[model samples]
Target chain A: MDNSVKLYLPTDAAHIQTLKPNTVVQIYGTLYTARDQAHKRIAQALKNGESLPFDLHTAAIYYCGPTPAPRGKAIGSCGPTTSGRMDAYTPLLIEHGLRVMIGKGVRNAQTVESIRSHGAVYLTAIGGAAALYQSRVTACELIAYPDLGCEAVCKLTVENFPAVVSVV
Target chain B: MKIVDSNKIRSDVAKLITECLITPDRAVTNALRRIDTDSELEAAAAALIVENNDIAERERAYCCQDTGQAVFFVKLGDGVQCVGLRDALDDAVRQAYAAARKSVADPLTRLNTRDNTPAVIETELVSGDTLEITYLAKGAGSENMSKLYMLTPADGVDGIVRSVVDAVERGGRNACPPLVVGVGIGGVTETACTLSKRALLRPVGVLNERADVAQLEKLLLAKINALGIGVAALGGRVTALAVNIEVAPTHIGMLPVAVNLQCHSLRHGTVKY
Candidate 1:
């Protein structure tokens, strides 16, 4: 097994740049969960010059819509959604100081370029490995967009959440 | 005639939803075991995927968060009597999803139905007294990558080969690699798409019966894997585990081709009564 890097959230741009593709990382810290609907709302807010629900600078956003927890669990089978679907809204977030993005699948060319230019990195949690991944999410709380249900923005405290650096 | 209860169908459907989500089909597991990893990245991905399956099985949790749209293909015999079959199945889906706390998002409204009801059920009347129900929990990621094309006969099998390869290449990592490519050839537009999805119900690594069709499947599989999309589209040699093709007679002038990509999770099952 390759040695894994332990990364704390709100990572610095220099720290992100030091990481390379295929570097196995165990992430520890707060990750904001957002998917299609939440992204749209955030992008729309930015368009309207309104403040976002959460801080964007140096923050990591996980693209996921978790299942409802079943008794005693913090979250249920919370895995990454396809990152491509959020491609349209990603570049703008990166421009606004988002430093890390986590999801599965390849991002579009523009998003990749934004990550490169804006000093952000893209990581992929193993797609379909929700059950295993959920074990790492120590706590979860709904933060915004309660009406969106599963697609709502939530804050997750992760402990050694496994992922691979896909883009840097 | 064997009399099966509608309640049985409902319960079985519910069981299938849970079972398929938690444990992968045997063929898919076998294929995953056989994946050839060219890099540590691929190896790590394969390990995580395998471990995820085990965790899902041990914990009675879903292998994927999506848990997917409840899609069922039911084949019923003329002699079998289940008066409220449709309602029973719907009820079963609702109860099962509720028990699991799974999400079944409404397509138009994008709201969680919370119970995963109103399954996309496709039924056919068959000759025997047995009822067979095949369940597929199709995640949106790969489903969004599906495509249908209306081609001139001039395009031929080569055209299909090109289209399938191009779709996989274009899809890249989005649909999830180590995919199962289902190709539907020769039917009309919607029928071709349905046939493509139905073709995915076949076990992984199984080929079409016709010699020519099987050859086409083999060709398409090779080309897709050759694209180097890798596991989870991360960049590896094992892009696709299998390619299954289904063909139907079509009008002489028009040929429609549909492609449905199933991610490595490949949550599918069939129950017969």
Candidate 2:
């Protein structure tokens, strides 16, 4: 019982409510990563029309702030952070061409409307499966906001990255 | 004289706390392993979260660098009377947090905030002259989702399962998984919740001795995992790593069940004196 939906960017808000509870989907291609602090930066960037570190078109943004990497590991416990915190920034990101949004928990009404309007979907990752999520990440490079500690922007490469397109 | 220099014991307790935070417990370890073999919905949810560990560690490093919330559950023997126990324990927490900040490389944790603060100190009087302490450092994600339902005797077992499943489904990905579903059945509503939290102290996969209660655990596990709320609610087969049921006989008319959700980063330790 799996269905596919389009990806939402960091600020996209549509299709959040339509997401039936428990729908599974596989995530493909590149996406931006951000959590509470990073979202604020992304939102501020939007307000000023400043170029983001990564292109927003067709990008899927996952809300997460992972643990530090061990000696040789790419990342640690890189699971989805809460989605509710990102609701405020979603609509704006969707407007900018973010297709798929990856996170956990329910989205607010505005976010759901934006997802439906923008043709973007929301996906959830296990909240605390850090070691497991460590496996899917192929590579990671710091993109911006190194000062924010774990909350910094980092570009991650994922392969066979399995995610359920939670929205219809 | 003094009851075994409770200060020294507190220091030792602090050391244990430090160790527990840096390591993973059996419950959390099992939860991670279960995600691997979970069903499709469960797997996907777990897989992504397993991926999120990197971020969690980073957050752990940056936030609450002090790791200051060092509270303990102490059981003092009837033969002993430790003066300044509370003040000493508080000093240990403060000292440990200070040491953690100076020596520990990780970031400061969020302490003294809503749902995160006032480190819980539960003390019980027991036999002997020694003191036993249990250290629990609960994180926010899972703790936020914990709930207690006051059920009537009529609600029975079915009611317990429904309430728990509903909590899990509604909790979604916020609680973090595969969660240790601690079902505290019986006692008053608040005590039921405490029982549930205490149940979490049991090792992963351990079942209650009572046949009927054990059966209820199995049924509830099946229903919850079936909710397809799999890992991080990302969807998976193993929604909860293990359901631990701890029950005490309740009032004739009341059947209270408290569901305490412990996140995948279950950091807790116990010490017996």
Candidate 3:
């Protein structure tokens, strides 16, 4: 097997620039989970000029809604959900220093342009490979919006999480 | 007369839900392993899919987090008497999604039903004494991309092909590439949608019994793959794993076609009792 391109998270401009589309990569380190409901809340928070959940500059957003973890497991089936659904809120996040976005499926033209102009990269976690991914996460804990249930914002520490660069 | 207890139905459906959500379908896994792709990304994609199947099976973990809403298609036997069918399924869904996450929601209110209750159940009466249940934990990603088309009868076979292909194109990467495209041709709007979804219950790569319909399936599959959607829409030759088409006679003036797309995960199963 070819060695996967290593990408440690809290990614920098230099690191993000080197990555090319379609290249297989394995990410390691910290990220935040935000999906539909959470995105709306984030937008609302921004509008209100309130404190944001996590520092967008240093934290990547994963469009996911993981299952409740079983005993002795950090998480359960932590797969990526459709990224397209987040198109409306992504460009704003990109503008706020978000460098990396990870999820499955396609992004809209608007979202793609924003990623390009802002020098942000979008990665695709294999949609069906959730079990493999859950194993990669060493720790997971609630970050915000716990009432949203699985859609709540959470922090994850992953190691060797596999993905492919989809947009840059 | 055959007596099928509702309690047995509840428990059996619960087991089926857990199994279908956690275990990769045998035919789909086989197809993924059998992928012959020259693209490096395609090769990588296939490897991940194969590895995921093994992990899910070994750990008895969900293949994807979405777990989705429980959608059941049932064939009820004429002589088999079972009351409270919906109640039994509701119990089963509540039991199955209890530990996992609850995805079903009140659309207008956006509050989850909590236990993923009130599964979408469709039952048909058949001639035999056995009750056969097919379950699909229909997730949001691909489900969101699915479409319904009302074409004019003049659209005919070519129109059907065009409609199905168009849906895939629009779905693009959003529906999850390496898709299982289910085409429901004919019927009214509702039946067309149901048939399209039911087509997904067929084993991966299986053809319809009708020769012409089977031929259409082959042709449509080729066209979808040719779109170069690839796995995860990353870009490659294999966009779809299979295209299964189901058809019914419709009114002469209208051609109701619905396209249901299933991601590569393809979590589904059949239980007969």
Q: Which candidate achieves the best TM-score against the true structure? A: 3
The positional error of residue B212 in candidate 1, measured at the CA in angstroms, is: 0.9
**Clash number for each model:** 0, 72, 0
For model 2, residues B107-171, the per-residue Cα lDDT tens digits are 35521232222356887777777777788766556766888888899998789889988878777
In candidate 3, which residue ranges exceed 4 Å CA deviation? none
- Indicate the residue-level lDDT of A164 in model 1: 87
Work out the iRMS of candidate 3.
1.3
Compute each candidate's TM-score over C-alphas: 0.96, 0.68, 0.97
* Candidate 1: clashing pairs of residues: none
Q: Please give the range of 10 consecutive residues that has the lowest summed lDDT in model 1 chain B.
A: B98-107
- The local lDDT score (0 to 100) that residue B47 gets in candidate 1 is 78
lDDT of 2 by residue, A16-106 (tens): 4455655554444456677766788888998998988777774667786665565677764466667877888888987887777777666
Better structure of 1 and 3 per DockQ: 3
Among all windows of 10 consecutive residues in model 3 chain B, the one with the lowest summed lDDT is B24-33
lDDT of 3 at B45: 83
The alpha-carbon deviation from the true structure for residue B144 of candidate 3, after best TM-score superposition, in angstroms, is 1.1
User: Once superposed on the true structure, which residue ranges of model 2 sit more than 4 Å away at CA?
Assistant: A1-62, A65-79, A92-100, A105-110, A121-123, A130-168, B27-71, B82-117, B249-253
